[model samples]
Target chain A: MSTTARTVVELIVNNHPGVMSHVTGLFSRRAFNLEGILCGEIGNGTQSKVYLLVNNDDRLEQIVCQLEKLYDVKEVSVRDDYDNTIFTRLHDLVTNAQ
Target chain B: MKLSGAEIIINLLERQGIDTIAGIPGGSNLPLYNALFKSKIIRHILVRQEQAGGFLAQGMARSTGKTAVCFATSGPGAVNLITAIADARLDSVPIVAITGQVAHSLIGTDAFQEVDTYGMTVPITKCNFLVRSAAELLTVIPEAFRIAASGRPGPVLIDVPKDVQLQQIEFNTWPQPGKKEGLAYFDNDALLRAAAMINEAKRPVIYAGGGAMYSGISKEVIKLAEKNGIPATLTLMGLGLMPHDHPLYLGMLGMHGARYTNNIVHESDLLIALGVRFDDRATGKLAEFCPSAKVIHIDIDKSEIGKLRRPEVGITGDLAAVLPVLVDLVGADKREEWVKRVETEKQKYPWSSQNADDGMHPLEIIKEIAAASNDDAIVTTDVGQHQMWVAQGYPVKSPRTLLSSGGLGTMGFGLPAALGAALANPKKQVICFTGDGSILMNIQELATLDEHKLNVKIILFNNGYLGLVRQQQELFFEKNYIASHFKSNPNFTAIAEGFGIEAYQVDSIGDLKTTLPLVMAKDGPALINIYVDHTHNVLPMVPPGAANLQMIGG
Candidate 1:
């Protein structure tokens, strides 16, 4: 069995109707699947934070580079060393609820 | 001045210079249709299905390089347009899709004809809007057009609730259309570095893509290649960038590319990829693609520069702006020895067939079409063996004339898109090159063709099987052909006649030669069905998961 590492990509984008689609559609069009995604409106409600959990591969850097090119995307950063326990915890809560 | 939301939307579209729209009307969108009747400025072409409307808009946008609009009512009408919207997004075609919604008061109540349009379209559109009030329509209408046509163009959706369309608001002044801005950002240092790489390379190849044609910079790209005496190979989307007869032009390079072209790319020392994302189909088994070449990637979209393969120099700017600067810096130089080597490979594996006397060949039919049209016709194709055959056999002399579903590989795009192209360029001859299987996917659009009486010539390659899939199964699955063959196919000529289109059927080369000229001169829609050899396969095909150099059968 092979092991795959997961990394979180954090993005700050203008809070608008299609910003999320533009960001995520880029990955889907490239045939890259995201593991998990978390998003909500943040500071002053004008901007939103989007966290995308994706496999850590050589293609990750390229995906991050593409995310930065979006017109509505204010900033993008790859948080490789950040704690990923939040996803694991959420997964467990959903499984327990089911 | 007081105006209803529907009126405001129609007036704003007129301000954007939109004189034509493709759409269908339903209950939820009756108010907008009512407003459209009052205005004689916008001519609405009624399409039978909502999806065809979307592709019709795509045809106009792609053919003219302008923002086109399409409309659909709530529920299934909106949902049916999803495939075409996604196609536009993948291919970067600029289109605005206006969809109607249930009344605002019916939010989340599972009301009649109400579905989550905003939620369903978010992942497919460049941007989408769900207007809350009638006053918001003022800003949303113009913004949708702006976002759709702006940097790296794609489709945008605006879903207005029925109640908002009925509401009225007063405003003294109308919102002006936004000014267009260029997305390219010049970087001189990177240009110099790329120039230096070009000057030092012994074996260089220019890889051009769809973005080059989208930006109308094929002249600059061709100039750079000719100035440096470098051979150029186009991606599927970049087919018409260089004239087919240009000396330095190698045919498309990818899985189904010419054997010599793939060999040249593999042996090259430098690759100047412009506006091309190193897609997997274009670069079979990435590890071995351009193995010895150092890449210099340039694109308007920053992320595309280093997304696939890490380039030695990545310039994130417009090709129109960057290519000229790089050409000036590099100046003129010649690599005769490299050009000679490419010629040697081309001679070693010539694109000629020995089966011309056996039966009707698809390449012969394409060549016949090319001869009759003088290589100047706007050729759109559906995906499959026929698409590849057209790519190989047809000689495209100009850019934007060869339109196909490149990135998305969507079938059923040709017929409706040809309708759109014919409408955009009324004087130009448009031809739809499709296969038996693909033509049936959206055959309903024949009614639209009959209604408009558009002069679109349909060339159908009938093999009675899903040719590409059958070929794959024959090679990989030990000839276990299941669900690949048509037990009994319809008489396409009869079907075309029923649709009021002039029709002909050809089973031999002689028939094709005689029928082609007569059909070409015909003033209305015509369908020429050419039956091809069922066992004949596209040559020089690089199998999946293999390197470009590992192609079998030339």
Candidate 2:
């Protein structure tokens, strides 16, 4: 995780239908803020990868712990080395659309 | 073997050794009921409502520490189960709730009795599933049970579409029943560190929560306390873990705790937290609870370790497995000074039960119930003054005997839960302590109790008001009582008689003293509506957001 405020979280989860709801619902229920999100089905489509942008605050450990407990979530990792441009571009696009 | 999804569910539950199931049937779940009718091994108890079905399942699960099953149909049926499911989540009770939904083809068309059962239950359940096909039932049924009964147990939901239930599937062999998975690992280094901390701390306290109750490590906990000269206090959910009169026991701590107990906990230099989440009710204020104490928290769930107050040494493992090693690792300390201080605090300010001999006080009633009933008789309580009083006053001898809705604090929990306890333990007696307000919420379950005639007793603390709310309003809200009072209180005795159960009333303290023991001794299901003055309040309450030490009125 960066000393900076923003960090990226990557999750490998089962690609079952309604699995996304479990992942995203957990973030909302725990009151963790998700700044940006990107996801796609991995090879064979049996599993999917999700990336979430969030602040690297004190609650980050708790956020990761809660994610690890989800039944569908297979793996969780914090990535300090990531392309910030992608999330910034997405934010810009949404701002322009509005 | 060729079987429908409904048949598979029944067959699987029977294989899991689930003999009794409770639920209300609807058009969507008729197929399951049909399968249930054919299965001679499994008996179904038809609850008056779907929520009661879930709570009834909880009654069985909480009493036995086993996974219990309940069923409901879609829409309103699924909606009603939310409170009970959420309650289970808060208390970490293991129950599997299966609900029926409309056909898959309907999609979001909003057909009759259609609701997004899966979506609604995601936040409440430990895990949930929406069966896409009948074939999924083979894996899903067993998986649901496994998830529900696994470490840090909580409710799980399975929503099967009506068409899926009718869809037939052929398989070579039936799948095995679901079994609970044990703790995979715990850090030995952390364990040793925890032991050293306990050995060194001068004034230590063991604070047990629901996890301790579920782990069945009462003996180990007591050993840890006795060896280290630590005083122990239980959360409401952990009341029965320490015997009511254990020498090292300091009773409950936090909101509605005795002043001395709360004070003693806050004064501790070391807090050994076991399977506890440090909830607001038990901690009063996060910053102020056990402020001087460095904690050693052991829970099966990892997320709870630093969720509220961070612990110095947190061991993420089951207490049943963790405590035995912990008991041996710690060196003994007399802690004469700490023990003397605890005793002095307790002696100087005794609990209401210590002095009050009034026959009509809830404390006396609870003590009398303990006297009349055998040591192991199960007790359940609705959320209110009576529940708090029972937590403070009842002499619960063992774990799983005192069942109350701790986290959710839901009313109407007592009656259906009592029904479940009675059903699960037909040979043993079960008692429900409810108030006039609480009883009315699920009063319809009396019919279920009457039909079964299992030895269950309903003791109603009739105060003609929402007693707890009224008390809070009196203390915190300036006593401008509006909706708290039930001016036209229904005669519960008459209502019980109408429901075809034996009923009695005791208005005076003298009558209450004479009649309670005899009523408790009677054989079949009975209800005793004992009139209580509304002025009586559960004491030693710490107003919300205050420190545990700032307790008021006992």
Candidate 3:
């Protein structure tokens, strides 16, 4: 019921230049919350797995639908049950690094 | 066969049946131009400015409902193309733009005339690509076309580095030419519920947008409006959906809409929104627009359904596939009382242009053009007061006949777009309505028109000022009138003649009777410069951040 509820959107996309921009630009352009992102190429370096920490707001469905429309974005899934600390622990890691 | 990247790009475009491409050549794109020189199947038009080339492609795309292509070099050329590409994106015109980027190895080094085109185009394009190798063109080129027109049409850009254009690859088999992706599957229960929503309403209104035209479903939507005795009001992009004289037609509804049309929409109990996004320009102060209405929205794009306004029943699919099903499912009714009320509202406040005394008023000029040209004639307009006047007064007989920059409201669109239309539909005349301010934005396109020798008649309204900005200043900013007035404007008739096209200078509406027929009947391009008074404002305007009901002038 909270507006600040956290979730992760996992994306399977083509591994190449400009794919990251296409994925991140969606959040910036639409003003959707993207608190954190984790990505890398997978399986023979032809595909990538991207995890975006975002707000679980009313716009999440529309956000997922828009992401699915991207040509390089092969698959999109919203993981409400995934451990969001994968992103939250980053704050502690950065503080300790300093 | 071994083919260079530039040759492969040209081959892919030719294989897609692209006959004409508008572009400008520079250092980065020299290789691509060299390949274009040998293509017997494709012809290129050299535009003076890079931005107009993008719009030239939009004209062909918007008028024909197909994906059109344009070309440009990197950096400045690609930057100049941003406005037109953004315009196409907002208006949903399908165009594939191929720009020549710097060498792939020198990408981050900031080499001469190099810019991150893929980065710049991300926000404005449906999707964009930075081609890394020559082999990638085999799939990327076709995919560009597919992604452009797949569902909701939009612009697509592919930035190819200079090195790639020279790189060669060998292949035995060619890939299939790209076509639009298949239509989405329909939900039967949504259609049934939408029909019930229409059947239950006592006072229903149909609000259609450019999607109706994009889907080529004008006849079905018009049938629904006529059969159910419901009034239909169109957005600026949707003007040609219904004939102007149709009894069920309620002109345009928005900021400058006829008082009655806006009032009727405000009072309606049901709004059947079709292929429309409910843009801010159409729904002034969205919180209060159609406050009493329950909406049933259908569009091809899924995100647009509830993006701005929530609908009682939302269906995400093409109107071509959706409208006919709803037509059969809903029971027809006269609803004479509601129709009578709408007619009375239309008569009482009425479109201000309806009572014109046949003078040199902009509305009269539009009517004169309508009278002189045949039904097949196409019209394109630039942004500002004249654009709104034409949208408010012109009698567009069919969809795609009226080409306008509705979503982005880009000035300088009329000239090049009209040129593209003239090139595409050579048999039909193209009438371009442009104001002095808008004309000067891309006035160099007159030379492109002269080179083609097509039938395009440019009607210029020389008001000696940015009329719309002046009007807004007068209303909203207490008539400060800063930077709105032009102390000196060019003699456009002389300018047109300098471009080697026929030109005429007229003073009054009576003068149009003589010059319009001569220009409209001529075989080649012409320009008619008519004198108009400045400070003339488009009326029935809703003040900034105000509701549709709170209007200041008519």
Candidate 4:
């Protein structure tokens, strides 16, 4: 497969009721179907990290920016390059699911 | 101990800056209605049906850009309003729908008028909540508003059980929303590459979509089109992106779109798809769509790109951000040959139609409506032949000026949508063009319009039949009318009158000429029923599953 250049969006959000709904709502409204989303708790259960991998770097940034403006969002970062580490983690998940 | 749930609802709505609510009272919501009578804080608009309430609320939301609220009882009442909410959601109109559920004790027992209202609404709404307790109603009220207005703007549902509506919850100032987490960082490098593709391509076309209108980037879209010497085509939802009269404007594209527009898109070297999803209607047999084009798809949604068709370059950023850069990067060279080629094609395959005007032509009616309304007036339409006629005949110059259920052509969409538009912008005139069949779906909304005193001009095209279905019969079904004709068509003017709305009937051209000006000048909701030929059809139609060149007429 041709290694397509992609972008990654990392979201840090408050662990609260309706936060996931709101976050998912943004993606649904934007029509951005997440290719890969990995979510887990990061700090003392108050916040968590959400990883979204999109093929287009420009799109990744845009999603990050919009996510940043949400009330429950603590921080957003866009990795323009498809980091091998994230892919490895995703690959592991697929392997685990299988 | 038993302060009614409806009372709490009234108190909560008053706190959320809602002075009025449009809805129908049903068995499940009767308690709420009883409580509403006791509260001096809010005005209740008792519409005839739940659907009208939904549309009225949508109208209010569109006018104010605030969350318009509606109420209904369980089951069919809630379900009846579903189409309107879907309409609002698809058009990005902000609305908050609150439904009354059965008492907690009867929950899941399949009690009278019980249905999974929340489950039914999930796909259409931005978010939904079923308040398990009255303590949550206060929170749900403000949260519903916040969610409906926060990002791209859409409908939200809060289904409150009867028992919860009676429970007491302490009211406080709405909490300041927590911080948003992430940064959307656009890759300047990707934009540069997309810009390079645009600059290098000789046949560049900007296919603007509903996203452009929603993002408020119409001006930017026009600037980019003008700057790059690019001919532009708008999706049905993107009708007003470039002024209809602009030299580069190629009109709407897709199945029913202009032949030249689709042909150019097919042959173009660079396709800049902005704020538009590659819907099947727009793409028309996607395997062969834009076969030669290197697409630069600019959308806020990450999933849209490559979902239907892969783009050469995809920028998932706001049209606000990407459009400016695209406009700035374009060179000073005008594609004169390209412009002439498009114009020649447009003339060759123009969006024209002709009908023997035995009495009234739908196109002429739409044209007159467009001409009479000022630039400030907003026009909305329901689906069918009337919608296509409006699209072809109406010359929209401003973005968001025309609101229609393009993605979901829900019949009976126009009246309520126009009500929402008129309510959204109270100062601006709003008109809804609804066909006879489409209007009957939610015709009771005429009473909703009457009760609210909303200044909406409704142009009801009474053809005594489903014109689109009739057209299909003519072309494919051997002209056998079948179930298409409503031989027992009700007198719409009398129906409007019964609803306490001013009504005018026009059967002749002279009657239309005399009545249109008078109705346009009047205040409050007025219905003008123009008797059109049942046999008259919208022409220049691409027969189903046919190429653009195989249009019925032009």
lDDT of model 2, residue B256: 87
Per-model C-alpha lDDT, please?
A: 0.88, 0.90, 0.90, 0.77
The total number of steric clashes, by the backbone 3 Å criterion, in model 1 comes to 0
How would you encode candidate 2's per-residue C-alpha lDDT over A25-86 as one tens digit per residue?
A: 98898899988889999999999999998888999999999999888999999998987457
Worst 10-residue stretch by lDDT in candidate 4 chain A? A79-88
Model 1 lDDT tens row, B1-554: 99999999999999999988999999889999999998889989899889989988998888888999999999999998998999998888899999999998996899888889988887778778899899998888888888887667889999999999999999999898844468667778988999999999999999998888888888988899889998999988898899998999999998989899999999999999988889888899999999899999988777777766889998878777788888888858779999999999999988775346664678877877899973567888998999999998889888889888887888889998999989988888999999999989889899999999998999999999999999999887899999989999999999999999889989788888888889888667999988887898887799998999999888
On DockQ, the stronger of 1 and 4 is 1
Candidates 1 and 2 compared: the better one by TM-score is 2
Angstrom error of the Cα, residue B90, model 2: value is 0.8
Ranking by TM-score: 2, 3, 1, 4
lDDT of 2 by residue, B388-418 (tens): 9899989888999999999999999999999
User: Which ranges of candidate 2 are over 4 A from the true structure?
Assistant: A1-3, A91-98, B353-357
Query: What TM-score number comes out for model 2?
Result: 0.97
Which docking band does candidate 3 fall into? Answer: high
Better of 2 and 4 by TM-score: 2
Query: Over the stretch B412-461, how does candidate 3's per-residue lDDT look in tens digits?
Result: 99999999888888898899999999999999999999998978999898
**DockQ value for model 1:** 0.38
| Chain A accuracy as TM-score for every candidate | 0.84, 0.84, 0.86, 0.73
DockQ of 3: 0.82
